[model samples]
Target chain A: MNKMKELSVNHLLGIKYISEEDIQLIFETADHFKEVINRPIKKVPSLRDVTIANLFFENSTRTRLSFELAEKRLSADVVNFSAASSSVKKGETLVDTVNNILSMKVDLVVMRHPNPGAGIFLSKNVNASIVNAGDGAHEHPTQALLDAFSIREKLGDVAGKKVVIVGDILHSRVALSNIFALQKLGASVKVCGPLTLMPKHIAHLGVEVEPNLDRALAWCDVANMLRVQNERMDNSYFPSTREYVQQYGLNLERLQKLNKEITIMHPGPINRGVEITSDVADSNQAIILNQVENGVAIRMAVLYLLASKIKNYD
Target chain B: MSQKQLLNSSEMTVTLQRLACQLVENHTTFQNSVLIGLQPRGVALAERLVEILKNDYDLTDVEFGKLDITFYRDDFRRSGKVLEANTTEIPFVVDGKRVIFIDDVLYTGRSINSALTALQSFGRPLEVELLCLIDRRFSRHLPIQPDYVGKHVDVINEEKVKVNWSEDNKENSVILIDE
Candidate 1:
């Protein structure tokens, strides 16, 4: 693919606009980083003394912890701005809050917000490197990276592999990011759920929208189970969690109907029996935990590359 | 020598055998010391060492491990197209075990650096050492050193050090070619 292996990581700041070659490099690099997770110190001084700011505009646990741990592992000084009860609401704009943080010489900014395009808007005004943790279901690029790393780790290379993402496609920034990443990495991706959750016209996003769970599960090499947003269930995704499980809960018998080597993955805060069963989630074939571990490595890579690339500019 | 250039297949094999001999002299203390190869070529070196150790000292009990340092590299963003890495199949503990990290060539030692990070995810280690096939002295960007070196040569940074397997590259030596 004539991969530009020599380009500075500054070239990869925006995940949504990345090329096929850049996506390939992230996966390959994650493989290298994954090997080092077993080390005694569990760190390398790649981005030593660099400062990274985590400006989470939304409430989170897994995504925040993942980026924080990733920054620490890369040896960057992290400045966290938790807006749980803070000044994001006191009539201050995202640009104003971001500009105040930028004035303090933040090397990179990792931001999450309920507003779509907030990260892009902030990045346009700031000189500091920007990574979208989650931008109102528009794109959560790093989450997608971890998902790719997890899928590739468990089922070999997910390229050309059939990955069925079942549940909440409309509100899943994860689903959007995964569709982009999986397609770039050569996975044949499909989104399956009730018509309410599955958007009608998303072929433009390069994924097949399958309404039938049985057919989707039958062909999937990796079944990525996303949490159905109960908040977004205002219309109808199905009757209820019990009904959904009965039809698509991925029980042992349902799991057995597909490939024995098929892997079941979930980004956590998992609903115990709704989208996935207890036995199925904990199965030897499941790599839900691997996704968590890979999350740190991917964020570390993203931050290190971004911060270091910015270093050459100044 | 200033004129040292591309090494042929036989030169690579003989040099590797000499490296094996040197490893025996330096590590004669531990009968239980483990030899772990970083994936691809590192394990190839380890396999060669096992055959040599068996023939010379008739020692076959020396344990070997394979490390796939895919997730441990620092400059992961610049690494090439990703593929499913070969599995890291270490079945023993590294804590208190005399461990030797082996690879094909030593340049910046970043791969070894990543391997060190990866080893910790498994268990602890008493001591870690390295054995490399070639030392490209001019290209070092880190303060790391190989415990055992096969051959030291001065090389340009723009050049590629291509190490071929037993079947390819005609023989088993290190070949230097321009980028």
Candidate 2:
């Protein structure tokens, strides 16, 4: 009965598109899915007849595979589509490619694209339930959810906790999604990075801009170190990788001096020695692997819920 | 919604005693038998039975757990509203054990079918039985019947059966609600 009032939205396009209640519903649902996946028989027959298409216009190994595993665990039929090997190589538009895929009777679409608002555009034009995996520097909702889930599991709750998002904030979809999700869940968010890599007018989003990494680390309950997106940048955002590591990298020495047990998190493909040191990434305090494990459950909850709203399910 | 009382507090107490004695007569030791309550509403009935079986009948070895069938329901998407999932806390395995599925009311028999499907995750049981406080005998959509029924009820499609316990509030009663 409580779930009937929670999660008002069917499509999880972005954190900005969902309310605080919706986030709580997703987290609670994810808790159930997490327990289900831990069992010997991980498969749930909830979405047995539902068919899902994973559309990836950009490169992704972790997020793409995680969604597929989640779909399989829910007993949903899955089809994978990549833009590089598909008709997009022959100059087919995003709408044309997706519509053609939908003609095969796909009920849900999990899309990851290079352009911002690509998911929003497809959702407006397509009939299937749209889950935005990642859209340029816009949002990656599931990553942020798993990040929050890991934090909540470790520190007990997200409310009234301080989180510092460090690294390339301007080009990271992860940072944008994390800020929206954490703030909505009652956590105070701060972004710390090089001034050139930080977005202007970010304070308008109700986030504090802390240029000093030391102060940010000391003040936060959790330090979510985002990867330096080298592929997204056409030119150098900072002078060099050496300088970036020297200024913003989270290492053992700096962590020991913090005088508190701050949870260390990184959305992986870790740069190793750049945004965070290898020792810190592998330390007991790091919840990077837990984020990956929670990612499957989060996506499962998202898919299971959206599949429940499909009108044609038999 | 308007409701009509079916069983009062004293009558409900007598009914539970009868059901508990019936359980003891069927399974004496209860060493290899386990009790599972369907979540959301069935839990209270199962807990009462467990207490009576252990305290009065001295069958203390009986295992009890809660099984949530929210995900296994056939009408989840058809219900048009997302149903909240409850905890499924079957701590011990059910392999080769006599499993009794308990619920407050049995209506269409669809929930028992889903519970059977959900119970497969734990392990295959030697046998399975259904026990309900109120059994709507004529309204079953499937070829299923309860092994132990406290009261047999005849109701139309527009009516609902509600079983309230003293554990939840001050009174214990069964009411038939007209929708």
Candidate 3:
């Protein structure tokens, strides 16, 4: 048998930093993990001796739990730290806090911070491999991977597919990561939202901006609905939540108007009746739940590949 | 490097017939017995044995599956290259049934150890056995010995055994290559 290849980069800071071959390799490895998770015994002993640290300087539910479960399923010892409960509350710096954790001999770090480029900063100052869970509104690499994997599972391939991301493009790490990942994999991307919520010069990123949601929905094979980040906005980007729903909400009536059925996706903690309705989220055309399930497998692939690069000090 | 042929095509056919007969002598009708082939190389050997068992002996109820042990290996970080994974297909239940692990060669006894750990994911077997085409002597790394062997040869640490099959677009033979 031929020898397997390793990933090009050691740290997964963002999708923009990795190559197209890295994404394909990750998707192939995720295919194997997807099969393993369905077996009677879901655990593997590949990372039995490795230790991982999850440092979350921001709040999250799905990303944290998904990374933890992926670590446990691979038989790796995990240590978790949150800013609310850790020394960050006492005014500790990012590099100081990570160096303190590195003193415990952690081999890999999965981190989420409120500031942009925090993972990039930690990767340069730390000795261990870093996986970016989320860095401010910059990028969520694993979420984008799982979203692409979910699309591959539903549509058989992501190449030549039209994907339109709707709502809150200005303050979404998911949107940025997904744009980078999708374009790298040969898919055309479009962003649909209000002018205020859309970023300035987003077209420079090579994505088309569609002001009307209905035209964006009719012109795509997949629709990714992003939640309105009310917490990130200092002032109201829209007049009201009711008005936002009236213009951009994905309801059954709007879906029925489209001639073709498009795959629906949403990264979790969705606001029902805001970006998407409850019925549309639970409909057959929606792959929101499948995205959650694939999240674990995608995370396992990332951890396993990174752990293979950890060399012995002695 | 120099190479020496150990077994030719005619010899391999006879040896496969004998191994099939031995399997039949032990597992009659194969009602509760399953044949598992280790992935990448062992799968070809297992498939050939299963064909002889069905075509010649008229035993059509034999349960067979393929297992991959990449994730269960012990030398993950010790090696220089990354380990690639293969497909594992086990459609039948192995609970309280006999399992016979089939492989092409038994050398160092480490791959079998990994296979043993990988088998637990399916279920517990009543008993387990091993069958191999070639057994390299003095390789008792884990105290594992094949129950049925086609041929035994004394090999050194610097030599490698290469088994070529028709399924891989090569002549059916086994050769020892000096490194």
Candidate 4:
């Protein structure tokens, strides 16, 4: 057989920066890593000589841990830098901080920042490869990749699948990334949430906006519930948590009434009784943990593939 | 690129049969021996060997798997090009088993080195052996040699070895390309 092509970009800034072939390549590589991670040793000496720095300007438990675990699994040395403890607290510029870290000969930088284009900005200035964990609401490319991967694993293919991303579209980096990735791979996407929480021109991105939770759930093959970011909400997106749940929350009753078997997905920190009920979240159809499990493999593939472009790492 | 055929289908078949008979002579039913093919190219030879061992030689109990060493390459960063990974599917345990690493060509033995490191994820084997279709002599950068080699060819740095299988290109041939 012919060799599978690798992603062309040096930096995994966003799903928008990659092509369909790149996405296919990533999924294929992730398949291998997933199998490797399940093995007894659960480690590959792919990046043994490479050094990586995880620079998260924003607080993130899952993404940070996932990237670190992935880096470790690939046998790459990793140094983690978080804003709460780093010089960023001392008001150091992003460039200066990363440059100082790069002076230690870090071959790659996996960053998560509150600013939308922080990763893109660093990729332009930094000498190392950049993997965007989550850059504001712009894109969490790895999350999107893992999400698609989980979908592919569960559904066989992302192509021709009806994926409705329910709840909080406006402030969701996952929604945007998924939209780009799923569409690129031939999945018809829909965004369903309260009107206030929905982003304008989302339909222009080729995703349908179905505000009716029942209608969206009944029409889709999968329902991806997004967390209501109470921390990020500056204004009232909806009346109250109870009201939102009553309208948009996916409960056992709502799920059973749908009559169609739709896979449930949550990016985690699931608002248990809010966006998705405990029963629904814990259902066999819910691949939330699989998404988390596939996250390491996907991140490993991303790091390993991107780090392949780094020079002279004997 | 200029191509010169080294081994055609019939010669390739005879060599593979010889390798299989030799393996049977030593393994004697493949009770504790597992065959691992290096991914992409090596799998073709490994698949053929497994088929010959199972169908022709009547040894149906041999275990076979594919191992990809894309991530284990020492020169990945030096290449400046991203190498896509192939599947590594070793479903059985390798602990205390005689493992034979199969590949289409062995030049620098870097892939075999990577395979050795990669095989650890499965388990520690009783012993590991390298089997290659073509062994390009004097090109190895490491102190490694194949235990079973079908053909040994002397080639300079500018030359390339191409192994094609019937499954891939409707023919089986080993060719040398001068660039």
Give the TM-score, chain B only, in order for the candidates: 0.88, 0.96, 0.97, 0.96
Compared with the true structure, what per-residue lDDT tens digits does model 1 show for residues B1-179? Answer: 12225677777767767877777787773465889999867887788888778877767677889987654556543443322345577877777888999998898888888888778776778889988888888677777898888888787887767666784435666777775
Give TM per candidate.
Answer: 0.75, 0.96, 0.98, 0.94
Most DockQ-accurate candidate? 3
Candidate number with the higher DockQ (1 or 4): 4
TM-score of 2: 0.96
Model 1: what is its DockQ? Answer: 0.16
Q: Which is the winner by TM-score between candidate 3 and candidate 4?
A: 3
Q: Ranking by lDDT, best first?
A: 3, 2, 4, 1
Candidate 3 lDDT over B38-68, as tens digits, reads 9989999999999999999999878899999
Q: Check candidate 4 and list the clashing pairs.
A: none
> Model 4: share of native contacts present?
0.84
Q: Over the full model, what C-alpha lDDT does candidate 1 score relative to the true structure?
A: 0.76
lDDT score of residue A263 within candidate 3: 98
Q: lDDT tens digits, residues A192-293, model 2?
A: 999998888899999999999999999999999999888877877899999999999999999998899899999899999999998999999999999999
Of the two candidates 2 and 4, the one with more favorable DockQ, higher being better, is: 4
Assess each prediction's global lDDT (C-alpha) against the native.
0.76, 0.90, 0.93, 0.90
Q: Residues A45-139, candidate 3, lDDT per residue (tens digit)? A: 99999999999999999999999999999999999999999888899899999999999999999999999999999999989999999999999
**Candidate 4 structure quality by residue, lDDT tens digits, A34-83:** 98899999888878889999998888999999999999999999999888
